[model samples]
Target: MIRVLEPPRLAAHRREPLLNVPPVITVLAAAMLLIQLVRDWVDVETGIEILALFAFIPARYDPSVLADGVLPGGVAADAWTFITYAFLHGGWAHVGLNLLWMLAFGTPVARRFGVLRFLSFFAFTAAAGAGLHLVTHEGELVPMIGASAAVSGFMAAALRFMFADGGRAWRPGVAEQAVHAPAPPLMDVMRDRRVIGFVVVWFVINLAFGLGEPAGLVDGSIAWQAHMGGFLAGLLAFPLFDPIRRRPGSDSYSRTSRF
Candidate 1:
C-alpha cells in the first residue's frame, strides 16, 4: 500500500462569520435603522422638523439663515450637525447601502484601530466632509444626510493598508496569511494602477451624479462633494489614525498583522 498526501480541509460548520464584521459596525447600523424608524412613524411636519435639527444644512453656518428658522438647541446643535448628519439618512436604500459599506470596509479599520481610535477617525472624516460641502454650497438650504462621506473615508483608508505593494486588494479572511509588509509609501500608492483606476472610477460616478438626476436611487440629491472631502481626508490623514509603528532597530514585519 502507498501513502498519499492531501491538502488541509476546513470543517463544514467553520464557514460561518467568514467576514468578521465588528460589533461597532452593528451598533452604528442599528442606530441608523432606529432613527429611520422613528422618522417614518412621525408626522410629515415633525419629520421635516427632525431633519431640520439633525441634517447638515449648508446654510446653518450662515448666521442670517439661522436667525429665523433655527431649532432651540442653540449653537451647540449647529456645530454638532457635522457629527449628527452622518447618522441620518434620506431613505431605506440610503441607509442600507451605507450600512453594507460600513460592515465591509469599516470592519478592517475598526479591527486595526480599535473602538476609540476608529470613532475618532470617523468623527474627523465626518467633520471634514461637512466642511468641504459648506465651502462649495454655502448658504444653500438643501439638507444633506447620509453616511456616504464617512464610508468613502473608510474606503480611502482601506486602500492605504488593505492592499499589498503589488496593488492586489486583500480578500476577506486572508489578512492572517498576508506577508508582513509595511503599507506602501504615499507616492507609490499614487502611482499604483489599481489605486489610480479606483480613484478615476469613483470620480466619474460622482461626477455623473453631480451632473444629473439620481433616478430615485437615493432619497434626494447625493452629496458627491462631501464624499470627495471624506476620501481625501482619510487618504491624507491615515498616518494619524494608524496604530502600527515600528520599534527602534526592529523589523516592521516581525509581528503578525491582521485587518
Candidate 2:
C-alpha cells in the first residue's frame, strides 16, 4: 500500500479541497432547493421569473426567463448561445440535480485537472452536448438547459480517476497501517466503482429513456447524443486535462510485504 509521509504533510499541492470536501454537492443542492422555494417571494419584487426555465445550452431561448417561448427547432444564429444556454433550466429540481452532480464529482476532477482546464472541458462538453442534441432533434424548439453535459464530462474524468490502473494511492504508513481496517463493501463501491456504475447506468438509462424515438420520458427532446459526446470527452481527454504524474513504475510504489 502507499505510505503516508506524516500526519499533516500531503503528497502534493493540488490547490483545492478533495471531491467530497464539506460535502459541497449536498450544500449546493440544498441551496438551490432553498432558492427555488424563495422564488415566488422574490418574483413579486423583482417582477421577473428568477429561476424560471430558459433553454440556454444548444440554443438560447430568446426570452431570458421561462414560460415565454414557442421557439424555432433550429440552432440559435448567435454563437454565444452555446455558452448562455447552459445557465437556463427547466425547473428548480433540474438545476439542483445537475449542480449537485457537478459538485459531487466535479470538484475532485478539478483538483486533478487544473481549475481552468476543468472549466474549459466543462464548457466544451456543454457545447458538444448541445451539438449532439441538435443533430438528434433536428429543427424543433427543444429548449434545453442544465449543466448535465459538463457534469457528464466530470463524471467520466472521475471514473478514470478512480478505476484506471497504475496510479498513486495515498497509502497509510506503518502506524496508520497498524490501526487500519478495510472499509465495507458498500463504501468500496462508493469509493471506487461508483463512477463506473454511474457511467454505465447513466448511459443505459438515458438510452432506454430515448428508445421510443423521443417519445418517452425525454419526449422528443432527448439529448442522449450530447450525453454520449460529453461522456466521451471526459473519458478520452482526462490525461490531457490532467497529465498523470508518473513516479517510476506506479506498480511497485505500493508495499508488497503486506498480505
Candidate 3:
C-alpha cells in the first residue's frame, strides 16, 4: 500500500504577554506611585510641607516670596522643584490619570530612547513645562504638580515615529518593528494629515481646558499651558533625543539603533 506524504505541521503561535511595558516605564510609574503613597500616609502639615518643598510654585521665583521665606528648602527648593514637581500629583485620581497616559506614550519612547536618554528627555520636557508655567503664572502662589507635562512630551515624541512608514497599525509582534522604523523628517511628519489631525485635536482639547476652568465648566484647574509647552518641546527637540540616525540625501532615517 502506498502512503501519501503528510504536510509539515505548523508551529504553535506564541501568545503575546498582556503587559509588554519596558522596565524604565515600570520604574518611573512605581516611583510616582510610591511618592503619592508617602504623601497619602503623611499628616496634613507634613503633606503641605511636602508640597512646599517639592511642588513647582511659580511664586518660588518671585523675589518678594523668596524674601518672605514662606516656602521651604530655600534656594535649593527653587532649583529642584522644576524637576521634582513632575513626581508629585494632586491626588490618587491625578496620579492614576498621569500613569495611564504615561504607560500609553512612555512605553514606545522608553523602548526607542532607552533608559538614560529617556530620563534626560523626561527631565528636559518637565523643566520646559515648568518654565512656561512660570512665565504664564509668575508670582502666582498656587503650586503646580503632576507628570502630565512629561506624558504630553512623550505623546508628541511618539508621533514622530509612530506614524512613519504609512502609519502601520499597532499589533502584537509588529510594534517593535514599527517603533524602530526610521523616523521621517519633521517637515514630512507635519505634512501628514494624520499628524495634523492629532496636533489639532490635542491643542483644541488643551484650549478647552484652559477656557473651561475659568468658566467653572471643569472641576479642577488643569495645567493646559504646561502641557502645550511640553508638547512643543518634544516635537521640536525630538531630533536631539532621537537615537536613530537620518540617512544623507534622504528624507527618511537609517535604522541604526543607538540604544
Question: Which candidate has the top score in lDDT?
Answer: 3
lDDT, candidate 1, 1-259, per-residue tens: 0000012333322333344567887888899899989998999999888778878887777877667546645677788888788988877877888888888778777777777778888888888888898898888888888888888889888778776545543643355332224566678788878888988998898778766746556756778888888999999998787766555666463333322
**Cα error, candidate 2, residue 211 (Å):** 4.7
Tens-place lDDT per residue, model 2, 43-156, is 453413331232433223334332334333233333544544555444555666677678766766654554456667777877777777666555434455556777788777
**Residue 122 CA error for candidate 3 (Å)?**
0.7
Candidate 1 vs candidate 2, TM-score winner: 1
TM-scores for every candidate against the unseen true structure? 0.86, 0.57, 0.87
lDDT measured at residue 237 in model 3 versus the true structure, 0 to 100: 99
Q: For residue 19, give model 1's deviation from the true position in Å.
A: 3.9
lDDT of 3 by residue, 131-231 (tens): 88889888887888888888999999998988776566355455666567667789988998888999999999888866666432222588888898899
Against the unseen true structure, what C-alpha lDDT does each candidate score? 0.74, 0.51, 0.80
lDDT (Cα, 0-100) at 134 in candidate 2: 61
